[model samples]
Target: MPDAPAPAPVPLDRSAFAADAVTVAQALIGTTLLVDGVGGVVVETEAYDCEDPASHAFNGPTPRNAPMFGPIGHAYVYRSYGLHWCLNLVCDASQLGSAVLIRAIAPTEGIAIMRDRRGLEALRLLCAGPGRLAQALAVTGAMTGLPLDAPPFRLLPRTEAEPAIAVGPRIGLTRGVATPWRFGLAGSPFLSKPFR
Candidate 1:
């Protein structure tokens, strides 16, 4: 009989996620984010810190950002632009108001499922946008307030080359434009549209 394929490893440790913008962004560079789907969906992510004035939670707790304040490892999913669903991983227990906005992902598994969800022929477009990634990964408002350190969804380490990173203004923000907190793979097609 042929050998069975190995089961995908489970990543439950919370320390792999950092509490600061640079550390969070750097740590997520090559990690795989698994979301709910047929076999499961894998994604890459980015982060932002509370110290970042541009960050939504920078001004202290608000009704819209209370989730980020309640837990260290939770999903702070929010309805952005009155339509788009933006995903964020809540970080820092003491800070209680910092998170990393998952800006993009490079699809590694369940491409067909993603394609159907995104309704796009082009692979890049399937998960190129934040809102689209949520749709493709089956993440919705229901994902809000969910535990990030447990099942249904989680992040895995990547062995691939930690691509050269770059930082700049966060998207759709008026303040902290010059803070250069946004981080992404340099010259990668998977990266979001750069501010400049």
Candidate 2:
């Protein structure tokens, strides 16, 4: 017998990101994210709101974080530790400064491209962290403020039933350490770290 065909990717409506960051984060699990058709399934994410001290938007908009204060359904790409790019999906209404940080993904498409960009053969390490995920997908500061539904980016809706989600405090955060805003696909080996 032949193997079953994978379901066609469903385009996620931009309106789907109009909710708060936490809501969007939890909903992002299992969805597919592609950058010029090179990406994979979202396995982990963290929510950030303007009120959260650990969030870049906590102190209000700046030249760099202005996109977080912009409209929803846009990218908020930024550099972390001045070393690597991290990708965030702006959510909520304009000026709300809420976004979901894409932490990890299970590579399902464009594996070769991800491997070349990451310079690693380990599939698990390709997109298992925000910085690595951004690199694997070729996300950069230039992508910031761009509409997620537009070219070079394609966020597909989850075609299957929602997977079980695990909740935990966000990683590398001193403030809001106990907020439990991090969400991930329960039992997914692709997560950056195991959720406790």
Query: CA lDDT of 18 in candidate 1?
Result: 40
Please write out the lDDT profile of model 1 over residues 77-159, one tens digit for every residue: 99887898888887776566777777778787888988887788787777766887778787787788788777667777655
Error of 2 at 99 (Å): 0.3
Which window of ten consecutive residues has the lowest lDDT sum in model 2? 6-15
Q: Model 2, residue 30: displacement in angstroms? A: 0.6
* Residue-by-residue lDDT tens digits, candidate 2, 151-177: 888999886687899999999988999
lDDT of each: 0.70, 0.93
Number of backbone-clashing residue pairs for each candidate, in the order shown:
1, 0
